[model samples]
Structures are given as C-alpha cells and as structure tokens.
Target: MTFVVVQNSNNDTMTRRELHQAWGTQKEKLKLKFAALTDTDLLYPEGMETEMISKLALKLGKTKEEVYQIIKAI
Candidate 1:
C-alpha cells in the first residue's frame, strides 16, 4: 500500500511511479475486473476518447487497457 501521491493546483491528486512494482496492486485489481467482464462487455466499444477514458478511469477504476484503446482509436 505504498504509493506516491501528488496534489495539483486544480485540487486533484495522483500517484507517481518510477517503477512497475509501484503500480502492481492497482494493476492486479484492474486485471481482475477485466477477467470478470463478459466478452460482450469487452467488445462493447468503449468510447476511445482521452477525456472519456480519464473519466472512466477515475470512476470505474480501470487502468491501461482503456487508455490504450483510447490511444489506438486516436
């Protein structure tokens, strides 16, 4: 549960990682959520917008997959 947290002028917070191990815990949670989703859900055309992805990442707690999809769509 060791994470780096930063506060921005806009009153937002985030973690800064210099290594993969720092993200391991969150990554595992995302992996479990991904595995639990049905194929239909996964293929349901997640909106590939950076803003949308960021919003969903904050709301649903997703990780790189959605970000990758958004980049791919771009």
Candidate 2:
C-alpha cells in the first residue's frame, strides 16, 4: 500500500487510495513544487516505497524524513 500520512491525534492513517484518491494531483504538485523531480522519481512499484523515498532524498539532497513530510503535506 502507498501510505500517504498520519491523519490525526487518533493516530489513524490512510493509504493513497483511501486518503487523497488523487495521487495524480499530488504527484503533479510534487513535480511542480520540486523542479528537480521527474516522473521516474515518483514511480511507486509494489513494496518499493522506501527505495523510492531513498532515491528522492538522494536526488533532492534532503533527508528521508524531509521527503516524507513534503509528500505528506501535499
């Protein structure tokens, strides 16, 4: 599952489908927001989220946590 973010004080969270239901929007926003990002960088194959984030962190010169926060915020 593609985890989006933690929801609230209740500690509930949602996956890509359950939450935004519009990863396309967020993906577009992400590419626009970070010009360095490419479509390949956003690719999320099954069970590859960590690798994807690691790649993003390396490309953007940010920590994984920062990358996660950026994604979550979008």
Candidate 3:
C-alpha cells in the first residue's frame, strides 16, 4: 500500500493520490539531478550531497527505498 499527504496554501490536506502525484513531480526532478552526477561525483561528500535525498524522503513521507525507486522509474 502507498500513502501520501498534501498541504494546501490554507493548510488543508490533500488525498493520498494527490500527494503522491506531487511527490512524483519532485521525484522526477530528483531523478534528473541524481542522474546528472557521475558515480565519482555521487561518492564525494562535498559535491553530490545525499542529505536532500534523505530530507526529501522525510518530507514526502516515504521511505528512502520508495523514493529511490521513484527516481529510478523517472
């Protein structure tokens, strides 16, 4: 099962699908950004930071693996 949460400008929450769609967009962007880096680049801490990846996982209320798979599909 999948779950999602969305907050509107007025702080109203959206449905799971709605939040997932929004996360899908962000995951696509993250995929692009992640793919643009070289393996070496990803290895270096100062350059390709994985912090945002972690943060994104938390922000989207999804697991790291879930976010990772999303990025892969994009």
- Identify the candidate with maximal TM-score: 2
- Estimate, for each residue in 1-73, the C-alpha lDDT of model 3 and write its tens digit: 4444433334444445543445536544654665643333222232222454466566667775665555544
Candidate 1 wrong stretches, greater than 4 Å: 1-10, 18-21, 36-74
Q: How far is candidate 2 from the true structure (C-alpha RMSD, Å)?
A: 4.3
* lDDT scores in order: 0.41, 0.71, 0.48
lDDT of 1 by residue, 1-74 (tens): 45654333444444333223333443444446556533332322222233444544555565646544332323
Work out the TM-score per prediction. 0.28, 0.69, 0.36
In model 3, how large is the Cα lDDT of residue 19? Answer: 39
51, model 2: CA deviation in Å?
0.7
Residue 22 displacement in candidate 2 (angstroms): 4.0
Between candidates 1 and 2, the one scoring higher on lDDT is 2
